[model samples]
Target: MSDTFDPDHLRAELLPLSTLQAPSEEAQAYQRFYGLNALGPNGATSSRIGRVEVGGYDIVTQLWVPDQPVGTLVLMHGFYDHVGLYRHVIDWALGLGLAVIACDLPGHG
Candidate 1:
């Protein structure tokens, strides 16, 4: 079997921020100096989101605080995928009284 490559170096090479303009100057690209922005709204949703550093990569873990506090739900995405792509699924999870957690893997959109 082949050896596995360490991705910490590659992750460091990715610039922390982008300069893409948004909505014809009506909006601006989000900037970060230290860590990445999980790209989610505050309030109930944000309260459940947590930063998890695993395998040298940052993963956002979101938990839905249910009225009765049942169990946790973890959602894993495929290659070249971002956690935001599962908005519909997350919403469904909320309706089911289960927590939702997702992340944007490296080199993924």
Candidate 2:
């Protein structure tokens, strides 16, 4: 929130990401029930990740363009959260042809 904080540089540095580890039995079962793939690494994917200028500030975002985007889905993370944490969600949205706009709000830890 302070002018001293450079969002662009921070985004370029340590973008948040969940470490891909062995899934629990429960998680695997849930994935099977929903016809979903394994989480994170083996899940839906997109590489168009970058920062976007919005409201005169650099809002870090990842663009997952679908074959035919039905519409846009803007995902705003809660306090102390970053957009990268929702990579799987964004991947799914891209697969469904929905453009995503995920933003890391100010003061995210």
Candidate 3:
């Protein structure tokens, strides 16, 4: 496919976190499915969810660490993809004692 599109404009149009309204029920359900609520007491050593400012946009980020981490793995998603789709990967990595850090790209889940 050949096309010309500018994501900069869309990124610029994003509102600040403070100015955004609360998430809807559907959004909440998705979050729950993705384990975005909080780290469960039964799983990995640690996990956290937060946001980072990038070029005037807030990008969602997450980290999962094993009790005895052998190394860190940065999990990146492709276009139109999100971390939720990699739960199995995360589980496997954690099983192998690898820490995982992931994020939701701009304009994606």
Query: Which candidate number would show the highest TM-score if scored against the true structure?
Result: 3
Q: Per-residue lDDT for 16-59 in model 3, tens only?
A: 33343454344445446765433323564565555668888688
Q: What ranking of all candidate models by TM-score puts the best one first?
A: 3, 1, 2
What TM-score would every model get versus the actual structure?
0.50, 0.49, 0.64
- Name the regions of candidate 2 deviating beyond 4 angstroms: 1-47, 54-56
Off by over 4 Å in 3: 1-31, 35-42
lDDT of 1 by residue, 1-63 (tens): 112322344233333222221211111111111112232233233223334566886654434
Lowest summed lDDT over 10 consecutive residues: which window, candidate 2?
Answer: 14-23
lDDT of the candidates, in the order given = 0.43, 0.50, 0.64
* Predicted structure with the largest lDDT when compared to the true one: 3
Root-mean-square deviation of every model: 12.2, 11.6, 9.1
Clashing pairs in 1: none
Candidate 2 local Cα displacement, residue 92, angstroms: 2.3
lDDT of 1: 0.43
Model 2's alpha-carbon lDDT is: 0.50
Clashing pairs in 3: none
